[model samples]
Target: MKPTGNTILVTGGTSGIGRALAEAFHARGNQVIVAGRRQALLDELAAQRPGLVGWPLDLDDPASLRRLADAVRERFPALNVLVASAGISRPEDMAGDCWDGFDAEAIVTTNVLGVLRATAAFLPMLKRRPHATIMATSSSLAFVPRADFPAYCASKAFLHSWLQSLRHQLRKVPVEVLELAPPYVRTELTGRGQAGDPRAMPLDAHVAEVMALLGRQDHPRGEVLVERDHARRWAERAGRYDATFVAMNPD
Candidate 1:
């Protein structure tokens, strides 16, 4: 996927990695439309960045996603990049109270179902571009599940599977599906208290690497894992990787 000279739509652009990516592309001379659930945040983004467009969006609802699609088609028909980055993450334990179960549902609905809905809505418009790119934000947990956030990990794993299937299906089309699995990042999603965790990577640091990866002509699909240790562990020994994850978090 080319870095600049393309119209892009980044979901969840209000904050976190999504915001960083939107700013990165905008700095590189790309027309960026930042979409999220909060109008106030959108307004703030628009106010802060000249030529940056912001649209209020709710990813969980298909109707809202379709409406956003229609708006995009009408306004920016040449949009070539669709970044499905808007999602929520929460620790969920099935054995806990009702809130825990609710947390699982909310995470799955937003992370998995939201991506599916948004992709279906904008797919037709994306095909019109020469080299369209569909980028979804997965997680390192997708490869190795984290016991604390069971649903979050599973949802990201589902995204990895879904994007792989979508990439195959779009082989004949102009669109290219890319799954970006980030390691723990210092974002609001991780909570303020967890930001300083040694395992967590800085958001700006990760975004820089992502920008470099996306600039390449031959961007790899399926799962693009970040953070050296995770990549190395997964690459060197598949059996060991599985064993480590299972051992660390026994069911």
Candidate 2:
């Protein structure tokens, strides 16, 4: 995507990387729309940034997504960039007797199916634009797995593969499909504790790097990866998959 002058919509644009990106893009002169579940947060965000829009969205609900699509088409017909930044992360222990499929189901619903559904909803408008971009957030764990977070890792892995096909199919449509594989960042994605974790990359630092990467058009083959994401993202190709997996899932 260009550095500016593009209308953009970011799902999960309430907190963490999503909000940061929305703000960054807004500062760049993009017509920015921020969609999320919390009305209060949306209102607050819009107030903070003059032209930034805040729309309500619940990715797990089909009807809500349909409403978002209709609104985007009506309000921002020229919108050419979509960032599927909405996702949930949870740790599930399969060995537990009380473990049911609920967490896994929820994770899949929000992280995997959510992006697919959103793409379907907005692709028509995107296709109309001469050039469009669909950027979805995957994870460094997508290339490997954390045994404790099986479902979460699997969901991201699915996106890593699915986005490849999407990129190929959208080639004729002239839409660029970008995948964001981020390493552990100081975000409340997992829990509030994560926000203060020194081991995790600082949220602002991560977003700055990503914005810079995009500004420089440094993404190779449409994968927006920062330096820290390299080891996990290429472990398999580097013949370190087993070692990485073991390290990430220590006994």
Candidate 3:
């Protein structure tokens, strides 16, 4: 990724890390299109940042994703970057007697299926470009699972494996597959006040570090694990997987 001069499309651009990344890229002189389910939020983001384009998209809907791909191909043929950042996280209590409140299906549908569908839709277009990048937002929990958000962590784990394979298959091509494993960041994904938690990293700082990593030309790898996440990012390799898992999900 050349940092600038590429047309980029970022899903989940309405809020959180996605929005921050879109804005950062836009600031660097790249033409950015922010796509999300909520038209109002997209419009607000567009309003707040002039020249930032907004496109309505529903990652859960296959038709919507296909339409988005077609629209992108027609509107921005030069688009060389696809950031599949849209995701959902929900707390699940397995101890509960009732299964009605569990959100495993929804989490898998959005986080896993959504990324697969979106990538499939845009892959052809991406392949046509001289050079392209496909980036997905995984989580550090993929390496070290969190008890509260079981499905979310599992979905990201799936991404870790899938993206690794995708990178291998596309190694001979011009496409670059990148997985961004973020630590617990202050974001509204889990509800109100989560973004302000002192324990969670600030959104801007996370984005800055991520941007810096992406800006590197010599950094050639599948995963982008930041400094804060380095501990868990290599927990298994560092011979501390069991300890970290127990610590992260204490009874």
Best candidate per lDDT, number? 2
Per-residue lDDT tens digits of candidate 2, residues 30-130? 99999999999999999999999999999988999889888888889999999999999989878989899999999999999999998888888888896
lDDT of each: 0.83, 0.92, 0.90
* Candidate 2: 10-residue stretch with minimal lDDT: 122-131
Model 3 weakest lDDT span, ten residues long: 216-225
Q: Which residue segments of model 3 deviate by more than 4 Å?
A: 218-220
Q: What is the lDDT of candidate 1?
A: 0.83
**All models, RMSD in angstroms:** 2.2, 0.9, 1.2
lDDT of 3 at 111: 95
RMSD (Cα, Å) of model 1: 2.2
Give the candidates in order of lDDT, highest first: 2, 3, 1
User: Per-residue alpha-carbon lDDT of model 3 for 197-241, expressed as tens digits?
Assistant: 999999999999988988885345778878998899888899999
Per-residue error at 22 for model 3, in Å? 0.4
* Pick by TM-score: 1 or 3, better one: 3
